[model samples]
Target: MSAEQLPALVVVAPLVAAPVALLARRALPAWMVATAACGFSFVAALALAVQVTSGGAVSYALGSWPPPWGIEYRVDVLSAFVLVLVSGVATVVAPFAWASASAELERERLYLFYALYCLCVAGLLGMTATGDAFNLFVFMEIASLSSYVLIALGRDRRALLSAYQYLVLGTIGATFYVIGIGLLYLMTGTLNMADMAARLSDISSTRPVLAALAFITVGVSLKLALFPLHLWLPNAYTYAPSAVTAFLAATGTKVSVYVLLRFYFGVFGTRIVLEELPMSQILLALSVVAIVTASLVALWQADLKRLLAYSSIAQIGYITLGISMASREGLTAAVVHLFNHGITKGALFLLVGGVALRAGHAGFDRLQGLARTMPLTSLGIVIAGLSLIGTPGTAGFVSKWYLVLGAIEAGRWWLAAFIVATSLIAVAYIWRFVEAAYLAPLGGATPRAGEAPAAMLVPAWILVAASVWFGFDTSYSVQGAARAAALLLQ
Candidate 1:
């Protein structure tokens, strides 16, 4: 299909497959349906990315209706890049789900789980693609609802509590988002982002506009789990099924970050957020706190899954730090880290999934001497871990390098130093796993810790391979992010 058709297809494709997955019940036939849906979404995202790169920004009026009057699905390089990240991660995570699900989920619920997964993907895609502010909330609810269910479906009883926590926080986030959208509509009498942007320019300094900004920022920060607002994340990741962990870890908060970008840069305009107000300072300070605090917490985690979960908060801090820089370089770093960290976290979580398959849990004590039995999986974890630490020649380095460059450009030497300092903290937490897996004995408890089934390993390795590949061959992702940043700044 043409690029213009791609947006509708992106949303509809998954929605259609979701029901088919539900109907495919018991036969395990839903796997194919889910795979096909994700595959189509992936291709659509790539097509959109290609079109955005080669043809520039494209917008589709829903039902041929113009914006501010009707909904618009905007596909700039920025949103397209995020679409690619989200859909691509969903597609990759599905295969891992096949094997991981059988062990962690009830047989009958597999189809239901996958159906919800597609719904979550659709919701996220809708959130990113739609140019309508109200429509964004609609999609946000769709994604949040499905995510709550997916998280709760974990085998452990704690999964229920984790999901409930996420639900409460997510609901609050969505409600705040709606309140903000309502405030914007009240001020501008329009639901479209671009239209609102143009109208909001006049009253950018008004109390209502400032209030809306505060509401939206807090709402998105909660969704993104920025710093102290991140209470729901550790439990959500640690107790959820491994495949769910991989998918949510890779795309969930990243999507929230994209929402922040859309509102801060696309709707409110950078002049108001960065200059008219003090967004940069607030974001920068919070981001630094998240990096240091989250890492400190991660260093003390005994469960490998929880450790990576805390690390995600720190990683998000890097992305937010980039946004706070508010320079082209900083935005570029934020965008690039969004992708790089997605793959890094996905690989790490998927590796944890593999360990779960073997020993039925991912506690650090259980993973001792796993290197001897699960050589390939452990090696993949090592590579991903190295990337997470921003080691040279890894995907993580590119973003951190750009981040440091952005700080230098902004003349914030201490910020750059803080970036490096946090990387050491990353190394410290990652090293805990490295030591437990490679150096310590298997401790008689993990005799069955041979290796995960091939299904799990394949998907895990794909992410690991991409982490290494992107680390070395940065021309594509970097260029995409740089161009996307320029458009966002414009």
Candidate 2:
């Protein structure tokens, strides 16, 4: 692939593959096309990341037109890092879906599943890669709409209601975001993010600009499921097909978080968002509540997926809490945790998919003595669970350590204490699973299905192994996040 064409190809490959997969009209062929498309995006993203690392930033104008007149695709340190994250997770999750989807979806709709899968990946990558603010909203909708349908494809009928709830909330979020973009365009007269940033400086303190910030913050917060706006997450995760849940859990909200970061520091600049206004304090307050409340809620969930879904909220809180600090250390923790949590949660959900495939559900009863049959999957979950709890020598601990360092550097010792204290709540929830799978007797709650096919287990373990590897080697994730954070501060 040409260096000049890599950015477009990264998004277009999956966009084109979606149609091809849909026309295939069969599960296997469609999945092959979708997986190949994700593979292409992954490779392209890695190449872009390497280029960005060696050089400064990569910028490509669409249709041979220059920026401020035509749409641009830009990869900077932050966006390039996120591009690698979304594409890599898509590559891993696509392979796992073949076995998981076959067990959970109706045969007739499997082709459609792959189609939406490609569309979702394309949308997420577009959101990260684009240089235009309005274009990011368009991609956000593309990802959200496809995700709604994908979540509805579960064999369980409740998937319909979950999708509907998400549809309603998602529509509202889209409306708010687009409205904010409109306000910014009216004030700045440019949709290009870089141009807008330059233009917004003169009018940064104007009422409309402040309003735009508020609109975008609330809108993106809803999209990312921060705190009370997260009402739709538990049910959606609980009922969605396992593969879809894994994909979205790893990529979707993280992309929204990226957009929020882009707007806060990249477009508006920290002087306005963090110091001039109360945005940082607001984010900090909400993040603390999200982490504490969500962890407690997760502790009581009977449905395994819902429990992990709540755990996702807690993790997102950690990421956002880091962002609220706006220090170099804080932003580094925020960006790196995006990758760490994405892989850790993705691995957990994938291993849980094995349980869902064998037991036909992930309820507490179905998980009893799961280790007796699905030993590999069970053990994988425990490893990932330790990561989730920020145990030493795991990816989660790396993120938590940075967060505590950031807090202490900012002189928020109470925040540091809270960070450590809340982790105990996570330990409680993770131990519930350990008690069920390892200590509980093998009962009738579990099915006779021996284990998930290798097609599923192997992909899940890849992410599990990645969590351990990254914990020891901080060269890629930590360094990338640090550069991204430094770039934003610049």
Candidate 3:
């Protein structure tokens, strides 16, 4: 296929594979199909990004129809960058999911697991690849419904409650979002995002448009689990299947964040969103609170998954905080952290899943002197944890440095100080794991758990190593973020 077909193929591969995986009715074959589809999409996304970077935005009109009248799939620099992140995560997580699901799920249900995984991946990729407002909402539901079922498939009973909570709140968020889209369609008479942007430019200050903005903000906020609306996240992350937990934790909220960014900067002009409205200030306030409270709460959690879940909330705060800055540096920080944090959290959860696999649980009690037994998994967790804590020479530090620079650029020195202070809270929580695994002594009679199988460990370590590799080489994460920021701000 030519480069122009990449956008369609990026979302279609996994989407089409879902039914094929389901019909296979076997675990290994289903997993192979799922993994292959994800791999194909990731390659397509990379090619799409390269094409966009070298040439310009690529637009694929459905059925050869063009513009506001027909559905359009557009790939610009920002969307291309995000497509790479989302599909890339799905690609890496696919093999990890295969190993993880085989361990945690029943033999009969394996096909179902792979099918839902493909659907979820397709939904997220579509969310980034689509250029129409209503189309994004549709893809959002596809992803959300698949994820809710995926979370419910967990080995833990609490997974049901977690999935239910996410479903109810997720439904509310979707309703609000579609309503906002309805308003946009009502006002603009166009569903295509580029057309909407062009049409809304003149009447952006009107009440309907402003209300649409408000609705979109609250809706996207809930989807992204921004602060107070984040009740569903911790439990969902805590109880889901290990692979589901890692995949959702890595990509779910990040895609929501991309949607939020797309709506705020891409659809609504920055002037109206930032100047006429108080979203920047509101986002700033909520982000700071999320960082502080989630970090402190994380410090007290006994379950490794729960601790990382809260850390995700705090990490998301940093992302939104960067978005709230409304400057080039701030936007770059937000975008970079979005990618970096996704990798860091993905590695952490995958390793914790390994702990749960061998130890029967991932609670603090289960992990005492874990380093003595599950050496590779323990070390991987600690390294990723350091990235979480923004230690020097790690991807987390790259994000932190930009966050501080953004704060300084905005002349919010106190906010800069607050960012660092909150990172210390991260250090404290990450230390909880360190103390449990490395520093604590194990009872003499305790059985050795050995290490996770190489399949799981290798996938987890790839992300762990990336968290460090990105720290040293700013070429991809930082430069991609810079270009995306320029595109958004343009």
Candidate 4:
């Protein structure tokens, strides 16, 4: 009820609703409970964002215990921005999930899907809000476990394999993260991030602290699917249920990236990681490799979901590229792209899901002539795809513009050129779908499928429209990212 409690409530609303939804024991009722909870969390996140933006950081100590000893829910510009993005996506995805889940899942499993969805949302929100290191790992597991189950609910048997692979890798990542935090706790005797930062300042050059940095970087990179570590993502996205893919593809990795930012800038400081250890060069090399390799792989994919899966990897490369620059503008670019790419990719995946609903498959072969049959869905895909290519007057362009500027500001002209050049690969992959839908003729024997149900179409288009709206009006995405960047750099 109090403004001070908004941060905790943002996570608690969905956490409490998960079990309540499960107890409902019916799909419709469970869905209503989940949706209501997500909506409430979204509102709380928005209010928290407003408070942080207007009044600066808001920290709430759990159980009235003072931190270093107590877990803290800290809302600053960066975390608040991410909180809004995660909760906002969950709110929109909740309505769209009803139609897609009912069609893809068994009646008995539908309620379970709703319950896991709430858990995932709660976990993501908690991860963003928490200011304690161990608390973050706890929330990360909550989200990761729920996500594994959601992916396994896919119709194909491969879904089980994909989920298993993700579970294995995700657990490894979490374990490494805990080990890193344990080392930090040993050095600082504190699990609170702010306190850890203060204590680490004097001992950052020590071997244990450096090892903690390595462990945390690799651990978070694995979770965020940073290139050579991205083996679990494509299959998981490819085999997962459409709604699950849309939700995870949009919010999951973005939150991981936020964690990386929190540790890199907020706790460890850029001087230690970026300068003292050559981390920027290492990140730059990996990011370039990810962009070039993943985009090329995406161009050759036969399945639409897999192509987008690879595309997500390439887009993440762009975000990391910005981070590697280690400039205020570069971090701002990374933050902006994190939000923009989430909306663009979310829209694209949701549209693909709509097509899957009507056509039963998202492969290029199945989607041939989709423009003629599922006109609205195809149109939404094209628009979102154009954004992916960083076309002017789209959300993606705003981020890309700042990325190029960041490279140029950092005196990396070649990097700027490479960024533009890699975008051509995006064009090629996007054109694959365009040609399949528009150029390929419809088979005479194929049954004509109409557009997706309004429930799905509306949410998909909402993100598509957001892509364009944010493109033209840069106030929220761009300016908020600038403020967030300033806060992180502090």
Q: Which stretches of candidate 1 lie over 4 Å from their true place?
A: 447-449
Write model 2 residue lDDT over 223-320, tens digit each, in one string.
99999799999889889999999989998999999999999999999989988999999999999999999999999999889999999999999999
Better of 1 and 4 by TM-score: 4
- Given candidate 1, what's the lDDT at residue 404? 97
lDDT for each of the candidates? 0.90, 0.94, 0.92, 0.94
| TM-score, cand. 2 | 0.99
lDDT for position 49 in model 1: 89
Task: Give the clash count for each candidate.
Answer: 0, 0, 0, 0
As for candidate 2, its clashing pairs are none
In the order shown, the candidates' Cα RMSDs to the true structure are 1.0, 0.7, 1.0, 0.9
lDDT of 3 by residue, 14-99 (tens): 99999999999999999999999999998999999889988989999977888778889999888888888888888888888877
Candidate 3: which stretches are off by over 4 Å? Answer: 443-447
List the candidate 2 regions with Cα displacement exceeding 4 Å.
Answer: none
